[model samples]
Target: MENYFLGLEAVHPSCLAKIITGDKLPKKAIIWEFTNEIKPIDLYCYLQVKYGSPNGLQNFLRNDSSDNLIHWEWSLAGQFGIVSIQGHNFRTEVHLIGEHDGKGLTLEDFIQQIKADFKNHGKSMKSVRVELEKWTRFLNPYHRINSVVAKNIKSLNSLDVKVDEDRELVKFHEENLPKLEENWKYVRDKYDNAIGITFGLRSMLPVLAESFINLIIFVLAKPEIKKNERLLQNTIRQQIDIRVQSLHLNCIGFTRPIDYTDDVCKKFHTLMNERNDLLHGNVEVNKLKIGEVYFKGKVPVFVGYEDMWQSAMGISLSSVKYNTIFDDHAVVTNFIEFILDHLSKDLKEQVQYIMTNSELGYNPANGRLGSLFSDNIADFRVSVNEA
Candidate 1:
């Protein structure tokens, strides 16, 4: 029921002049925009150190991820505002907007609070940079700028009043963001480990793609076989292919595979072949389109690097394109989604079904299938839900 508003914009020349003169404080206005080179995850962690809990702020801080950047707003009574945080990798941007209620500390005060607490968290003032800027203004009325800012502030609010006002979502996000942060940190540290070595992302990409593909196959197949059977079975990949064919078929609720049509089937087979080559063979980079590299096989064909990267990152290829060689996580993710629309359908039916029904969740037994299934599902679910 508590509502908060925050708006932020990059600093412009006019805003800089105002900041230098102290002509406008964050308290005088309803919104403040801050930019810093510091990571958004670090900032949120900083806020938790300063503010005690993730719940103290909006859902933006709780759900912002590499794939799912978040923005939010709220308004009630005389108070109105919005706050947003968006991050990609380590880079971050923030915006806050609202009506100034006389009861609390000003936005400037909050920024200073962030700066002071940031220091305790091993961040410097320069790293936790904050600024104020007006990104928009009403052209017709000069005197009504304040009124314009405050007017219909409720419209900016994104409480999702239609669905328990995001309580379940808020709880889910609060519980998972830190875990996501930790997982990404692990990945980042692993990546950083390669810094001193001769290894490049190009070679790593294929390995990552192979891992992702095997992971998906393993998750789809784990429930049907026991640990020993999983390891002992020589036909694990064949079994997984059959199950995936079934799941993909069942996902569309079709007697025969529909979405996994002939074209998709061909693509899937090709993708599997490419994954196999990357895992087992020497890959050759295309001289012209390094991004579209391949392994020499029965036939030489270029892999869809853009499609795989976009699929892995859950984003589209940028308008600007270039030739770069790398196997991508997107290929695996996109393939999974391509089959099931989202991993949720596959997990709820395949993985969660086993967990809820079979001995997997009942007994706290450690196994390769169980561990991989649980970890990957949890991670994928969080990412999908956040998305």
Candidate 2:
């Protein structure tokens, strides 16, 4: 908690004259919800005019290039000590801070007083009728997909190793053949699950990449690019490869575009092709070559064919291995990094913040103000005295 009182010492003389010091800190608070129709700045301006210059006012802003307001605090005249007023996320709260001795203003009393003031000042402070709704766009889906892919790979590896161990046991003792067969069943089931999960990853990775790049352009693109709806739509609708390659040059005026031949760029295009194959239901199948031969007492029991035949279809997803998924995931991450690296320092930092935080703060007028992380909230003042 920060001692906002320390700053109050320098308040204007007229406001300071009304300030009162108390032995006990204020504990009671009254909150009023406002419709989004009213902006926080408008209410703050009104308070400034009504109470003259406040003892202290602080604007808590987003930690991004936008510098949009997250919340604000104003210390005004108080009968007890200093009354604190805060506007945050479409709500205003007034805190009572002084020695009341049971004779100070009550909650209802202050509510009526504020209501009258609003009415006299020609302000229509409407109370919220419905619960506040919050919508968040999570930016870390790539990371989540990577996690699922990793877990699937780990499960597959464990099943494969078990199957190999069972085969070795069967070789030593013919009676262990049943165990080997059972382990093979486990491997088959796991393989089927992996195929399905990997297919989803393949489909989503490309889409996530496209969404990410377009999001960057939408949020941080040059003013002219943003203002023209048609241009913005056309740019976003372009082939993902074109968007990825041109992101730097199109969004930032001077940076060089990523070369199509760059390894990262090439990898991204390959991922897109794989996604396209899946989307278009393109199938390719070739005769699988048999590899290892398993024998049961001079009788061939099992013959290992290439892994491709086991795929859901002859689709490219059939060739996906754990390493392949890892590489594809890396391509998206690396390409995003490459694009961000070419951005100006400030833009890079802002985009990085958006990517790192899970929840985006919404402003009706601005769409997205920025993100707010739990740690950022933890560091902020929880109460007026801590402001």
Candidate 3:
């Protein structure tokens, strides 16, 4: 039950003051700062392990390379609120407020969680501790501005003018820091709704795909069901008791089933296997190889890990081989497109409505989903066309 105070400013102090004063909509807030000892990619992995793919309850996302920041918040059923990791040059700072619920974990607990997650991922924890210690030093009350001024030294350059201004600055920071915390609730809610769309699609794609298959079965079996109503009804009830994959295969077989060799279906099957692996806790990182020079030390687990955190992806001793899955977000997009291309006109409209309603579509879904097929799936279609 330790108290954690908000610290530092990424934007100008005056701009932050304006935000606290409600003169401007605060574009962002600061939570923690660290030198190059801690990398953004490590933070990204920490998030993936902690929250498991941005389900709004514990959602997070990294910005583009230009921004080089990760935006996320403590979302344990309304515990901690919005937070951001801002990186500039070789330094990074996590900025956030403790406004939402008093039950959020203390700063020490959160730091320990990171250390544990890092060590569990087969990485060293000593470096993590060193960087965290720096954060503690920065936040130390003994070294605070208020304390420095209290023990006035004659060597201070602008003694009279600066001291008076410093006192007022301290007063301003104290008065408005709590006010900024309250204002951030609105900002956090907006990001949560947007992240929810991506999360929902990932979880719901398989169900939607199965629904399309079921529709196909319903249409094809209509004549049989009509002819032998009682018998067909019993058979249908029995079929419903089977596994989803079997049902999907049976429905596909009834309709001109796409073969295992077909590229789209092949990819879809691979995605389904990977999704099942994830759901069942069988996910693993594929061993890393750099050209002819084999590296047994490293493994690629998450989509961006190979690109961002190569060092942290290493295994000190053992070698374990595993199959790779496309990024979960990529899998969702490809799966939806696969279904969209096969469904009937009336069915397509229903699928569109399901995905694009105010609940899912309120934030990012409309623009993102609309562009997904056009921008991403279009390329796949081009290769098929060429073939």
Task: Write the number of the candidate with greater lDDT, choosing between 1 and 3.
Answer: 3
Instruction: Quote the RMSD, in angstroms, for model 1.
Output: 25.6
Question: Candidate 1's residue-wise lDDT over 274-360, tens digit each?
Answer: 545544654554411334455777665666544322432222112111121112324433554465443555464554343222122
Per-candidate count of clashing residue pairs (backbone under 3 Å)? 15, 0, 7
As a whole number from 0 to 100, the lDDT of residue 221 in candidate 3 is 41
Residue-wise lDDT of candidate 3 within 1-387, one digit each (tens)? 332222211233343334445733333332445554546556645554544433321123444322322334322221243444443434444445334234554445545555545766544334443343121111222123212322222112212322233223323365756654453443334323333333333344444444434433433344445356684455355532242224334332232333445565556565556446535666354523332334546953443333211231222111111111114334445554654555556655655544432221111221112111111111111111110
TM-score of every candidate relative to the true structure: 0.25, 0.58, 0.25
Which candidate achieves the best lDDT against the true structure? 2
TM-score result, candidate 1: 0.25
When 1 and 2 are scored with lDDT, the better candidate is: 2
Structural RMSD, model 2: 9.0
Error of 1 at 341 (Å): 2.9
